[model samples]
Target chain A: MSHVGYGCLMAVDREHVLRSAAALLTRRATATMDEVAKAAGISRATLHRQFAGRDALVRALEELGIQECEAALGAARLDDGTAREAVRRLVGEFESAAGLLGFLYTENQLFEGEEQNAGWSRIDARIAALFRRGQESGEFRIDLTPAWLTEALYGLFASGAWAVSEGRVAAKDFQYMIVELLLGGALRREES
Target chain B: MSHVGYGCLMAVDREHVLRSAAALLTRRATATMDEVAKAAGISRATLHRQFAGRDALVRALEELGIQECEAALGAARLDDGTAREAVRRLVGEFESAAGLLGFLYTENQLFEGEEQNAGWSRIDARIAALFRRGQESGEFRIDLTPAWLTEALYGLFASGAWAVSEGRVAAKDFQYMIVELLLGGALRREES
Candidate 1:
């Protein structure tokens, strides 16, 4: 194979390992590095070479999650026509990252006094900006601040992920369930 | 003091220990039983006498969480009025248990294959019923399932609790933040 093709293959392999680690860790937060490699179908030596250790692997996962969120935000086009439609698109785009996001959400609770991944703040600001746009456009209620709405979005994503995992809700319904309730709420609209 | 008064004092002490454990564990899930006792300002021996072991202590915490949830549901008078009003009251009442709820929320994830504390399913049913009532009353949208709404409530509560703890959102806004978002969504009403 050509050098460029081999490099592409390596990138694909790295992505596979990261995704496998994310899936396994999401199911069992305390899984060891050896177990992570086993789950990823790679040798422990290769796993170590790929990721120096558990901390490095976790950091890589964090990076991957951030990239996914950034990509999803970009694809959703938060600056598009209507903030509501933009949010719908965002949730739809974000659906794929829910499992990885859930793992990171729980992992973050352990960072009490420690410095958190800076990537999180960037993602938060982006999401919050979407809510702010909605508020500015009079598309969203001002009573709920952008910050709180952003936090709520994270919470609901984690919740929806868990619910889907436990068979409490269908996988197919995940995006619709979150988007409708989030954008429309549980309340039925009455005619003015 | 009378023997009954002395017993009452012991009960209060036990309750205090449980609450302290919940608070500490919410902040640090790995807190030791000894640390829990210290946080409660009691001896480890006394803590052991009250709760046999970590499992026993966690079980006691689960019971406390359940009782608080049931109490909140009762105090909210869920069946007496409009589902919207009932949910507001329920969120108001449940606000106090957010710390314990948050701790249990994380703790349960570790249960993996273990039998979940039955108390949780009972609470789930009760909360789901409230959502069902809302839908039946035309006060809530029918698109979202009662089960998903129930799960969303859990997510929002945990999110609000964390946001409050981190000072991301004001402590006083916890109820409003959850209630307004859960009921009204981020979108502003166009006419009504």
Candidate 2:
């Protein structure tokens, strides 16, 4: 194969490995590197060559999660229409990354005092800014701060992912469950 | 000391050990039993005498969590007031167990196919029933199911616990953050 073709193939291989690792880790946080490579249908040697060790693999996963979240945020068009509509769109766009996000959400607990990847702060700021926009526009309640709302969004997304995994909630309904509950809540609206 | 007095003292020691273990494990799920004993200011021998092993200790924590939840539910007086009021009361009462609940929430992921403690089912049903009661009373939206609502509540509780631990949200506002977000959501209510 041509050098350029080989390079493109390697990029695709890396993407595939990262996704497989996300899926495996999402279900079982304790999965070994061999387990991760096996899930990716690749050799452990190839996996190690790609990621030097568990820390490297995890860092790669964090990078992938951040990229996917950023991509989702971009696709959601957070600046479009009303803040509620933007939130709905964001939840819908983020559905595909729910598993990876859930994995990262729990893995983050292990960071302790270690420096977090800067990508997360960027994503958090963007999301919190969206919440702040809603609050400023009088679309969202002011009593609940944007920071809390952002954190709650993360919690709901992880919960929705787990619910879908356990078959307690339908995968098709993931976006509706999160968006409706986050924006509208469990209370019945007087207008509705 | 009399036999009864000795038994009572042993019971108190066991409770202390369990709470210490819960607090330590809440922060570090991978903490060793020796570490747990150390946190409780007891010897490993005494810890083992109380709890046969890690599984036994975890099972004890689960029981404690379940009992606390049940107590909270009973105190919330689900049948005596408006659904929103009941929810607020429940959140207030459950705050103390948030850390232990969070610990158990992550720990349960390891049970994969192993029978979950039956106590959880009872707790789940009771909580879900609260949502169902709200729905039947026309207090909650019909779009979200009780099961999803229950899962979301659990998610938010864990999220609130973590946020409080990380100092992202004030420790004092834990109940308010969860109660308001879960029942009322982020949107500004027409009446409020």
Best by lDDT: 2
Report per-candidate DockQ.
Answer: 0.71, 0.79
Q: Per-residue lDDT of B1-192 in model 1, one digit per residue for the tens?
A: 457455545453787888889889888888888899899998889888888899999999999999999999889999978999999999999999998897788778777899897888999999999999999988898989999999999999998999999999999999988998899887788756
lDDT of 2 by residue, A1-192 (tens): 467456545443888899899999999888999999999998899899889999999999999999999999999999989999999999999999999898899888877779899999999999999999999998999999888999999999988999899999999999999999998889998964
Would you give the TM-score of chain B in model 2?
Answer: 0.93
Q: What's the true lDDT of residue A65 in model 1?
A: 98
What DockQ class does candidate 1 belong to? Answer: medium
Instruction: Report how far off residue B15 is in candidate 1 (Å).
Output: 1.6
Top candidate by TM-score: 2
User: After best superposition, candidate 1 residue B158: deviation in angstroms?
Assistant: 0.3
Model 1, runs deviating above 4 Å? A1-12, B1-12
- Stretches off by above 4 angstroms in model 2 are A1-12, B1-12
Candidate 1 lDDT for residue B105: 84
Worst 10 residues of 2 chain B by lDDT: B4-13
